[model samples]
Target: MRRVPDVRPPALRPAAVLPGPAPRRGPVTVALAGAEFGWGSSGKLSAVLSALRERARLPLRFVGLASGLGRPLLAEHSVEHWYDLPDAAADRRAAVGRIVRSHGVRAAVVVLDGAIATALQAAGVPTVFVDSLPFLWTEGDRAALPLDATVYCAQQCVGLPPECEGILASVASLRWVEAVIGTPPAGSTGTPGTPGTRTWRKALVSLGGLGAPRLPDRTAYPRVVVPAVLDALAEHGVQEAHLAGNLPAGLLGGLVERPPAGLRVTAGPLPHSAFLSELTRCDVLLASPGLTTLLEAGRLGVPTVCLPPQNLSQIFNGRFHSRAVGVDVRVVWPENVFREEEALGLRAKGEDHALELIYGGIGRVAARADGTPGAAGLRAAVLAAVRRAAGGADWGALTAAVGTGGAAQVAEALLAIAGPTPARGA
Candidate 1:
């Protein structure tokens, strides 16, 4: 029998130095806690942590949860330590307490994991919650999660409750992109298309790390959507298309193996720098309503078309971003995916009291997939959006709205909350 290889990343340790004059103050450490659903959360966390470590200018130690998807990325980013938190509440609390005490952790940055956030707060560790979706806090009795600060990302997050303190910003992964791929010129729109020339447009199809999750089978939607998208792009004079996401190799291979005649489709996960480079060159980005990918595309001024979202939060994000930037953004979702009666039931239960839910319901109505329109209808919608995007997108307004220097701003906040570094006195 063949043995399965271990996919878990190895434990990380802090770098050691030769003996020298001991400083008066011990090292200051900060812990980051979040469950890695996909590359999005971990990518942002790594970028912020890297920025904080460099800018803080103190002896800093890093601790993070050893989530499978995030561990490798954290290791790649050189985080000092990774811990496996227990599932049980008491055990989780004890584990967090031990980490804080052992590492001398003064503060923590949590990415939308309420259990960890609550545990850290109970342990007397100052905690900052990095939230991407307004409704994520509504899950599993975590609505009352206490946070010292909350960092909201993208246009969808505007007007979220300002708990303790809030900093509105663009996708955090842009920091990583800027660090790796170099920043694009300010106010520069995407590459100009040759007018009246039937040139082949370059399109990128990235449906994000997990694809749509609310479906009965999360992976099924992409199989149907991708082929149809490729067909649409081919029909509309797109010759070279790349499909990049955190999809399994087998799934990606199936999609790329048989491309429409004269259309070359290459599918795989590209490194961060390479992915950003492709985004710069592509005329349009056909993607799922992932906040990271959407914000990145908006920041780069690439026109975008989002597949119907599997969940309510994504619905809100897609519509808000499309309207905010005047970009040719289209959100396509199957009509039957969400039932109106169920929605009414949720509203009746007072769940839609939050503005996020109310706005999301509006988005769902506007962007319904309506498969009765068939592949031809979907193709036309995609083609039209692409044509508009190829003309020019509102890169300047989108970038300005999202703001720059987000990494620096967040790092400064973290350092301030951490208080003065212990003095290295005589």
Candidate 2:
């Protein structure tokens, strides 16, 4: 059994130290937070951190706000402080204000966690907000966002649907940016996927961040999606594959009676760097289509296929990938299960309403597998989608469509927001 990494930082006890007056000058403090939904926010946060470090004129002090689900992903970065955000709106604002005052936080970099960004600004801290899913937003989500953020960096997409317009227009200073994905290795001229037929030997199936707090049974996605994905990969001659994400325990042994193609499959969560390493080694990526992973794989020129999306943002991501590459690589539920567009239509009611349809459909399929109704048709749908991606795909087109300079772009914006004080804080 391959050991799954427990990447959360170890808690330390405060030790008494010789009392020395706090230094008058040091690194400028920057508070970071990603939406607790998944690893995408943390990935974007890490990329921006790297960019800030690379481009900083003065030393930087990094802290975290609401590192709940994203803590494992953020463990790799230098976030000296981590504070769990409160649930109540009033408490959340009070906690953020305390963090800002205590750390002397001058500016903040927030990805998707709109509430925290709004709170930071309430505390008089300038926030550079990253809205990666502008295409998925609606009027219902307006209150969560810091509409008057100092700098709201909305990622560029193929299209901003009607649902997003009102919320996007609400932002005070919205600046468009390229995909905020991790940078590729320097001087590496690796070709996309496998050469010739693109028959993949090693595969990576990413279920994305599965610990969605909304989900009662997070296993519903992996239990149903994994078997279908493994079947497809095996049929395509893949010999080895790694299933990456925060997944349920004993899911493989329980769900998959037989591992396809005599294939070796390892399931577990990976830190950002390790996940990128797996991307480089694999010939093809079959994933739940989180925007960050798609954009990163695009930068790496990796052949990619979209598994059924688990959320509103993912639906847009899968569609965006298909449009950019001119390939219908996304696997979606059957109409009998739930029409994708219909589910999307519920965005006005809130992301939860849209996700209810998606999750309910997936739950039905999973229940069917347990002899409730039947999951054969749903599994077959996924199988077909994976096979279609194998035919041939221009995966790099996504990268070309959205340049990979977003990290640097966000970093520059933060510096500008930080202004003369922090720039000269040293």
Candidate 3:
């Protein structure tokens, strides 16, 4: 049986002595970058990677192991081959190393931290872990996650979790792609809307891509939660309600079947742009806490009624968003919201009432994922740093954060940074 390297290393004792400065590479070379992008989730991630790659001139060869969920969006950017390897992490690392050598790749970029990332790092590959997505980096001992260097969305989001103070990369995600990407559909100005100023008549309920790939409603969290919202809306006399998400209609058939007469539920897949646009149109958003949707809704100035799922990661996301910014809160008993099926059933009808209370207290806590001044500023820095290190002509500072990644620039950056490393125990 094949074994995967324990990427999350065991606890280490504290030390004071510092090692002498090790040899520094003349430049950075990126061989490949992997992100599990698909239609519903990680679409922004792949796009961000592409843009970063282009700016850095790193050549990227994507390995579409899981499925072509993000293939359509990827196809639009560049027609790269969909490479796949064995499922095991060790095997993946081996395969990736082979590909890197064959393609003459030096370092690899893993868009988000996960099995693939850990595996690549285990293979002794020079890696850059990009904390672009909201991966509760707030809690983990990031140093344990294998990587030569790290980049995060913002310094606020990085650092050692409370339990351990380990070495983490100076790279901040927010700083990495600010100027290179586009902003959310909502304008970037003032503090993000809080729950106090805006009054929402009804709370929109969804679990986000309910029937889709990353998150499925096998346990029917949506079924339990949406019905509660429907009941709440009816009681408040909020006749018209919009249900936006990808929850399967069949799973939610019962809730919709008797949906209190006048409420309108529109459920299907909407691209990220359209999704943000719809958020602007809606007043209240009641849903599970997913990074993309939650962040966008917050950015759009929409009050969020978050029902965090059972997963520790989900709970962390909900708690962080709530505490970090002021939003309404429903303290579901037992840390795990997924376990509270009974609560879901009882509160399903009262969700709208909760939303109303939440709307009454407008709060501000969110940043635009793209094109905001903050985001744009970060992108320009990365581009400038890469060009200076590469000795490339100073392309003036990047002003706007474009939504798409530029692969050609990535290719150039990677080659500039890459150099020969001796095989194990040279």
Better of 1 and 2 by lDDT: 2
**Model 2 over residues 1-426: C-alpha lDDT tens digits?**
121122222211111111234234457789999887878998899888888877766678898998577788767778888988789999999999998989989899999888898899999999999998877778887877788999899887777677678787788997888878876656544454432355668999887767776776788778777777787677667889888876666775664457875687877778887788888888888889999999888878778888888877888789889887777888886676678889888888888898888878777766774632235655566667667777767778777676778888888888777754422444
CA shift of 126, model 3, Å? 5.0
lDDT per residue as tens, model 1, 3-106: 11222222111121212344557566788865545556665575576566656545677788645554544554556788888878899899989888887778
Q: Where is model 2 more than 4 Å wrong at Cα?
A: 1-25, 189-196, 249-258, 369-375, 421-426
Model 3 TM-score, 2 decimals: 0.55
Best candidate, TM-score: 2
Q: Name the regions of candidate 1 deviating beyond 4 angstroms.
A: 1-26, 71-75, 135-144, 147-200, 209-216, 339-374, 420-426
Q: Candidate 3: list runs displaced more than 4 Å.
A: 1-79, 98-108, 119-126, 132-144, 149-155, 158-161, 167-182, 186-191, 194-217, 237-258, 331-426
- Compose the digit string of candidate 3's lDDT tens values, residues 106-162: 556554434555665565555544443333332233443443443222212211242
Residue pairs whose backbone atoms clash in candidate 1: 308-332, 333-369
CA lDDT of each candidate?
0.57, 0.78, 0.41
Residue 311 CA error for candidate 1 (Å)? 2.1
**Candidate 2: TM-score?**
0.88
